[model samples]
Target chain A: MKKERENWVDMAPDALLGYAVVVLALVCFMILLAIVVAGVRILTGMGAA
Target chain B: MWHRLTLEDVKVIGHYLGVLVLVSAIGLVPPLLVAVVFGEWHAASRYLLTSGIFLIAGSGLRFLRVQPGRLSRQQALAITGLAWLVLAFFAAIPLSMSGHYANYVDALFEAVSGLTTTGASVVQDLDHLSYADNMWRFMMHLMGGLGLIVVALSFGLFGKGSASLFTSEGRSEHVVPNVVQTTQFIGRITLAFIALSTTIVTTLCLVKGMEPARAFLQSLWVSISAFATAGFVPMSQNIMYYHSLAIECVLMVVMLLGSINFTLHAEILRGRIKTFFEDTEVRITAVWLIAIVMVFAASLAASRLMSDLPAMERRGLFMVVAAYSTTGFQNVTTSQITGSFASGMLIIAILMAVGGSAGSTAGGIKINRLAILGKSIVATLKETLAPDTARITISYQHIGRRPVTPDIVREATTVLILYGTTYIAGALVGIASGYDASQAIFESVAMASNGGITSGIVVPGMAWHLELFYLLEMWAGRLEFVTLLALMIQLVVSATPSSLAMRLHARRAQRRRS
Candidate 1:
């Protein structure tokens, strides 16, 4: 299992770049959304009081 | 020795281009009528003058007595690339004359944007622009989304060059065996959808409290924009100006249908409903859309940006679909999108980069190419894992199930790399011109993929060189790089001293033969 995982990890950079481009974008969006949502909630709570 | 273009090549290209220009002149008539009805005399006269110029130029070109043989692939590519640039120049005339744009370049930018179905506009205060001008802008969308060559062919323009011309316009599949018939079929499908969408949107606009005439016009414009996935809006605020769920829903459906493969539409029209679910491209697009929406929705919910489920669905889901379809329609302002959805901008850019399916109005890397790449990866893994003597085969349904060949994988990878490199190059240009990396990437992908969604970076007076770069990007993106590259190479080769001398010899030979 470990050997197989290592083999997959050693895939060509060109091949990996395509997947990385998509995954990185998705991750960035998710994290940003979380932070934005928290800030919006905090602002709204303060306004309500 | 490399084959060089003769005077015959020049005449042949001229002849076809002249025919296209003549046909394009007819496109001006509708806008003229709109201007007359709306009493916009200034806009009306501009259309008349522009149309007249095109008519004369087209007639002169047709006067070139060129014998017809099928256009070589190189000539077809040159004609296709040259035609868009020429059309953009002519289209810019009326746009610039309207005095709404800062200069000719700004108008040309909008013209290229419209004709490429990119939907990015440099027009300031669109709400105050003349109705005729607005009509002309969306008219470019309608013509360009169908493809200028497809439009010309639909008018019975080509003889033997029809197939090459059709394919050269970035369409990979035909709905029918005959090119003319295929174009006609595409035209019919588009008009039918336009009628249906216009009716639905008109009714929705009426319900949303717009006046009858304005509602109908707005409905027509939005319907055409949505169906082209071209995203031009008559109003400054775009779809958000209406603030109606029903309108957004209708536009969303239109965008999805517009982005679908035209071949699939033909199949469905023939009652092959199973193909929709079975086709690899369609299935992949559906899966991608759903996954993107889920992530987008989660992000929206977590960010508390919209405050409720309905708001999240309306704003979040719609933006995702818009980007995924490569339709630039927005229910939010540019600043709101850039500021509020800052983190999610990368997501939208990625969606834009992936774009819609092949043989559709929408542009991008295309779902078909991505699906092929995915399948290729799996095949590679299977080959690696299996015994040395064992042969593995992979297949997916397009028109029908076909085994994936090495050539198919190579072609798919080449296009993917081209798209990636172009996307990066455009982003680099944006960053060099003083945009932040994220904003640069977002706007670059939007321009390169014909997505038209902006991160507030593109404006009328920002920088001339950047606008020029984007103009080229939109042109290159719309032609899918191959035709443009072929056109460039053909120009370079034809302009060489040896090639020019060879052309002169060919002309002498032709004269002697005659």
Candidate 2:
């Protein structure tokens, strides 16, 4: 998987590489947003119980 | 020892400034066309009048010709510092006549806010404002976010002193060897991003059931605003007017892109994805943002500002991103921000203060400075613990692995101190204008950081003194203090009486002789 990722990074053209970075950033933000939402849910649920 | 501005210096500065004004006059054409297309004859006439004034003033100033050569360091600084104010003055002319502002000062405030990319507004009825006026406002954002000098440099306006003028506007990095090519590359990259983002946003706007024309216009304006990280939305309700999760998410991405350093953009564009990811600014921003977002969420949840998790995810998350980017797009209204979310405002203020990457459109002390300061602390610790004869060297990765020299540390700390002082001084002025402490600090940070987040204190009828102070804060912040200080020092020296100047020169000579 690491090799494949490296290969993809190496092979992509400039425009594609730019868009790929954007996609990676979007995924990261989504994960972070999910964490925040989940953490708040757990905290609020604990408080209510 | 400071030298006063000679006549030659004044003439050269005036001539270049005239060139810049002429460029700014061209900026009016689009808005004028927009007015004409919409059949807003009154607005078009106002634009025509403003453009006519710009032409006359610009041409008149151009007549002050000193043989064209490289701009002196002082000359470059003066032109860069004066350019923003002059453009804003001319830019405000049509806006003041727009009938949406209470007075000329209010229009000028809006113009400064737009040019500084602070996103604050004092226009009375933004929703009812004409297309021409709205276009003008966002055009200011486009010009200001690109740095007025940068835009001029991209057009090959200056010959020899372009580098100094470029740095004078607080831009230090060159993606390309030549200053002109670098500026042009920056422009090309900006337009490409804007084009891509606008297409995506216009699609989302259409999906949200907006009319085709309005959707297109809104998307274009917002694409410029977000990519510039300038916070002005066409609607008065700001981003919340849309309430689409998808639109907000896209804008968030664009805002982050806007605030990322241009060199990183260049790297990405060159397919150096690995280098781009390994960038010190990128890594630091990632960690800082994740940690801050968590803390911001906790603050919101603890305050019971919004009980629902979805609300936390939507409003809380978006505001944190917006604040950190210094983009000033708010999902929450002023009352909610100043009332229920009051405590979280400080976190937002801190985020604005620590802003995004240096050499980007975003303002504030910047992440690069923060990283340097952090390394300085660690280096100090290492030095203290090392043996008496030991020498410690620290390094960090930006574009490459570069040693952390004292000059770098000093530059970072100097800017940090300047930003700190300006924030405090602005807050004091806000307090003197009778605002509460938190409100004053938040507004001051918003102004000084060019964050543009408001807590209801920046209204059309705010005290003239406070309004003027905010304008100065925005101006100083956008110039990043050093250029502003250079301008100020030169102004003071020029204004000194000739006898006093002579006496000072004599005293210096006498001291030398002794």
Candidate 3:
């Protein structure tokens, strides 16, 4: 357990999670942006009808 | 039943507070160096004076120290509650001397806003303000974002009762077993993200033809603000000044990371991707973001507010992220938000009030509490559908499976009620100060959630009473009701005549029993 904990700390955990979160955030943003575009289209189509 | 605070109690609290203040004085040095680098001698003098005051005051309190021991919960609450206000008082000294604010109160407002990581400001002519002053503002953000207690605890400044001090500052989970290691981990992660982001943003700014020196400074400031989930901008135009999609996208990513729970970050660090995704806070935040974005986009479409699709996508996606993260980095102007985006402003208000995850830099009724409350409703429905003696259990995945007991639900509901009450009271105060209902509510939610998105009501020379109340709101909101209420109750109990008489009576009863 001690050795395992040491390896974890030595991995520079900051960079590991920092870069991962950046990618995850971008992916989430893209999906949310698509939802917004679709919602806007549906709303506008209803209004025109 | 409560014991009256004695002189020794005051000294113990003061001793810890003094250490915090003296450590915070180190914050002044970087800004002082910036003032010297830029040849802003006037600002340099003010920084020197404030440093002197902090040292003298800190030493005076340090003299009153008692025997070092573990802190009682009340003492921790008092220290945590008073630290922000006291630091703000010392922080305002330099800003008040900067000649940018209209009065001392305005400077205090700016200091409080910065220290709370609320990002609201009342300084006049921010565009022309000295670089040293801007540095100081973002410094406040970085310090306040990690939390003053967290910073002190990270340095192992408090000899005992560090865990109580940690929780009193509204943080419950420890990423590591030791509170000190947990804080150190938080500091390390923040620095890593800020460094990476500053590099990306600086390159983007240079590609956009900004001067190399100015690009570096602006990038650094924005990176710190975004990673801190703080809203202050070096430029008066806020995020609009960049107008670069890449820069905005980068900031949005950083803001999202900042608003996530630190324990989740640790899980991700340990390669526990499944746990990260399965956490209740993350799941609820994903749902809330999607729902609010869809509603906000529909409102924009119905109102015909930004008829262009690309413009809507850019502003819509960014504003939702900004408001939802409670970062308050605005790309849309206040006029636009108040005028055409009026319907959208209400959506932003809801996002701010609901806020980001618990145990993070972001403030509000956190998504964790909301998740517990949300699960409670489902549990209630399950109970209703079942026959008698149908044993039911409800649990949700945070770090792991945690039962959502009645105590958890009650705790969540109490905080929700407290936030709601404060929002209503603040809005009433705003309306009484002669603003319209929509503006009043929007501004109130913004201040209370530490979402610094303005609606043209918070300005250089606003009403003093309104400004004072907003300052209190930001302070109380950051403390998250419990610690602030504890401090307020302690004050009232100490000061009121009835409480004093009761204390005497209790003392006599103790004597008779003895």
Candidate 4:
């Protein structure tokens, strides 16, 4: 049972790495979105006022 | 020494191009019929004049009596690039003649965008545009999406050069052994899907309180746009004009179908159901789409942009799917999209850049190249980590589990870099023209990947140089890079005199004496 557990742990990084990559991508996208939304709002608000 | 191009090369390219032009003229017929039916005599005359021009040019070239022969690789590439340019020129004629565009360049931009399935439009007052003219615009999407060369080949135009010409247009797979059969099969599948989709969308539109004539014409246009993944709308408000979820759902399915490789459709039709899930590019596309939707939904939710979870999911998923499929149908107006979805715009642009499956109407880096690049990355990592004696073999399922080779990796990387550089260059040009960086990059990716989703950068009266730049981007992106490179090389080789080397040598000798 312990050996099997160790085997699973050995396989975890590849799975973890995939998830990590996805999370990183999501974070980057969210940050970019925030910046764009903020920028557009400020620009449009200025134009309107 | 590089061999100089012979007169035969020009003749051969002209011969096939003439045949393609004639085939393109037939595309004008459907719009002409629509014009006559609608009693739009002026639009009909424009179509007639354009068709006549195509017929005359085609017939004159055919009269040259250039014997048909196998096209050398360079000639095939040249024809592939030149055919799109020539067709765009002819298509613009009718568009300009309609007086909808202020100038010829705007019409040409529309033609390029339409033919490349880029979906960007500069024509204002789209709601008031005549039905025949509207039909012509969407027809360009259908022809361009199916590939003009494929259409000509379907009519049994070229025999020996058909394969290379087909490949040059960015299609690599064949449904059948013969190129002509493959083209026909693709056409038949497209028609079948369009027919079914139009019926369904039209019915849904009627159920949603739209008038019968408007419903029918809009359904037809949307069906073609969806199948081509072209994202053109007869109405200026786009999909938002209908305000129907059923219509959006139907269009989403059609766009997904359009983005899938046609060969996969053929395989499924032939009872190879496993091929759909087993295919590498399709699998990557599926995963990529899910991730994008998740990211989009999360972004919308995090920002509290939409009023509710359902609204967020609906709008977010629609945009995600549209971008993934490279179909530019928008439920929101330009202002709402930029204002509300601003946070997610970059995500959408990235999805557009990744694009749909290869060998489909969609464009971008293509899921296949991305998959190959992914596998190559894994292979390199394994080789670096393993012992020196270890043989690291990487394989992925395409048609089969093909082993990853250096050549494949190099080809994928080269094209990816080319697309990336071109994308950045377009953005730089846009920034130089005084547009904001984010909007510029977004529009550049949209244009480069043939995604019609716009950020208001592409307008009726933009800088001519920028318009020309986007036009070239659409052309280059649609043909992928190799064909354009071949065309450039061919032009240079043909333009240079054979004695230029001798002249250079004489000049060098004189310089040394002096």
Per-structure clash totals for the candidates: 1, 0, 0, 1
Which candidate achieves the best DockQ against the true structure? Answer: 3
**lDDT tens digits, residues B344-458, model 1?**
7888999999999899999999998888889989989999999999999999898789888889888788878888998999999999999999988999899989999988888
Between candidates 3 and 4, the one scoring higher on lDDT is 3
For model 3, residues B14-114, the per-residue Cα lDDT tens digits are: 98889889989988998999999989999999999999999998888788858978899999999899898999999999999998999999999999899
- Taking every candidate in turn, the Cα RMSD to the unseen true structure, in Å, is 10.8, 4.6, 2.4, 10.5
Q: Whole-model lDDT, candidate 3? A: 0.88
**Inter-residue clash pairs, candidate 3:** none
lDDT of each: 0.84, 0.88, 0.88, 0.83
Rank order (by TM-score, best first): 3, 2, 1, 4
Comparing 2 and 3 on DockQ, the stronger one: 3
Candidate that would win on TM-score = 3
Error of 3 at B346 (Å): 0.4
TM-score of each model, in listed order: 0.89, 0.94, 0.95, 0.88
Candidate no. 4 TM-score = 0.88
Q: Is the docking of candidate 4 incorrect, acceptable, medium or high quality?
A: incorrect
Per-residue lDDT for A1-49 in model 3, tens only? 5995687678656646655764776677666676666666576674343
In Å, residue B84's CA in model 4 sits off its true spot by: 0.4
* Displacement of the residue A9 alpha carbon in candidate 4, Å: 53
What is candidate 1's fraction of native contacts?
0.00
Instruction: Candidate 1: count the clashes.
Output: 1
